[model samples]
Target: MTTGRLLIVMNAGAGHSQAEASRAAIRAVLDAHGRAYQFFLADSGSALPQQAALAVQQALAEGGAVIAAGGDGTLNTVAQAVLPHSLPFGVLPLGTFNYFARAHGMPEDIKAATEALLSARIQPVQVGLLNERIFLVNASLGLYPTLLEDREAYKAQYGRSRLVALWAGLVTLWRARGRLRIVLEHDGQRSKLRTSMLFVGNNALQLAQLGLPSAQQVEQGALAALALRRTGLFTVLLLLLRGAIGQLHTADKVLHFTFQRISVRPRLPYGRRRIKVATDGEVGWMSSPLVFAVAPQPLLLLCPATMETPA
Candidate 1:
């Protein structure tokens, strides 16, 4: 959409050989289309913010757009850097599920996705902010973070795929036994509750696929929270099946709500201050009283014109 040029950032953490293969494939598509672009290869997670910030600065100065060319985590990295600049941002879906990209009609096929990026229009799309970080898909606390941690480990050992991800999740759930005692505050109301997983969703498509109630409210500027009640192992397995088949709405034990802003504070007796959190599948520790809210300014994204809700 920005006719100036393009700055594409690739998540090169997947290993040098594999990353280069994907890079070459993407380069072929862009070259065949005669698009003007440059690449920023992120060899490590810790360096992404610094590298992406440099790329974003250069793109902004050149009146061009910046593109995130991998999965949700990669997008999260590039987005954090670009959001501060207020320039048009783009995505090249290369991640499993591709939730954020698919919700905006981004094609999953490489050639199709490349073509869409070439002629996409600048559109303002809403995103969730986990404290000071940007999460385009979702953010969560409790068991979900553990699941992401295990998933990455499995990917390291068994390779990346849907089956491996599912296996990792099942293992985590089977071993999951802890309950979070927290004070949840939202909508000027507060409550104390115990739960295994506390998930806050921002992407309508992902929530809709999970058969969560009020999934569409996310597009209406509200986030949906799902709290899993502590249950027997068999019941938890049943819940997983339901979620997989888009029947989670039938689970009576799950608590669901919609809100504009929410705060979570862990009530630990030992004065523990940090808790593990997952934003768009990346897990890390953050101070308690985590705040999840819609960003005051929407992200300026490049998407095909056929999208229904581009602002």
Candidate 2:
């Protein structure tokens, strides 16, 4: 709510519903509030991060907030761009989970989220980083990234519903294979583990929903590391059920811990130095010795008054 205008960065891939309808509702809210705003739409997937970064540059120069009007992935891109500049950021969730939005008390309904933006205030929100990359929600290695790929494929082929996501996850788990022998170092302690997946949670809502013991720790600015000890298809499926029903905390085969920083060195196959990693639903590769840590500086996110932040 500065004197400057709002820079809205929208991802064209947000096919959650009618894109035009979401745009119209957002425009209606801003117009009703008499707010000055500009939209920078990312028409193609390849240019989304660049577009968001461009919006951030403009917002930084003009003294305004950059609003991401898509899903968590879009939010992550905008956050990554805004993090370096210490600019105010906003979100209008159009994703399936909307964990980052909902965890911060943001309404997923486009019009309502936009309306909240009109009266929102800036707060320092926690951020997680995989090396230099920013992740607003959670980050994972191994099967989760593969599952995300399958989920996107399923979403494209069928639809973007929870059922579809769940189906994709089931299929991925059933087909899951291989173990990652990772040497983890954190807080002057070292451990070697062989697991099918290593999941680091930065969002309290998602962690709490999963009944993870480290959820409160995540809320308090620490990241939770969860690893699956067994990768057998049936065991993986049962673990998935436990996670789905918020009983992961009770599972014996899952290793859970809290950390502010952790180093992961995966024992890879010959000539392979990179591995696929997923952050907030976007998958990519990072070099060996992937380090997951709480960003030194928190993101200045615009949130409604109902949202709370740690002091």
lDDT of each: 0.86, 0.88
**Poorly placed runs, candidate 1 (over 4 Å):** none
Can you give the lDDT of residue 298 in candidate 2?
A: 91
Residues 152-220, candidate 1: write the lDDT tens digits. 999989988999999999999889888888898887889988888899898889888889867778888
Candidate 2 weakest ten by summed lDDT: 11-20
lDDT of 2 by residue, 199-274 (tens): 9989988998889878888878899999999568888878878988999999899999999999999999999999
Kindly provide the TM-score of model 2 when superposed on the true structure, using C-alpha atoms.
Answer: 0.97
Q: List the residue pairs that clash in candidate 1.
A: none
Candidate maximizing lDDT: 2
Tell me the lDDT of model 2 at 257: 94
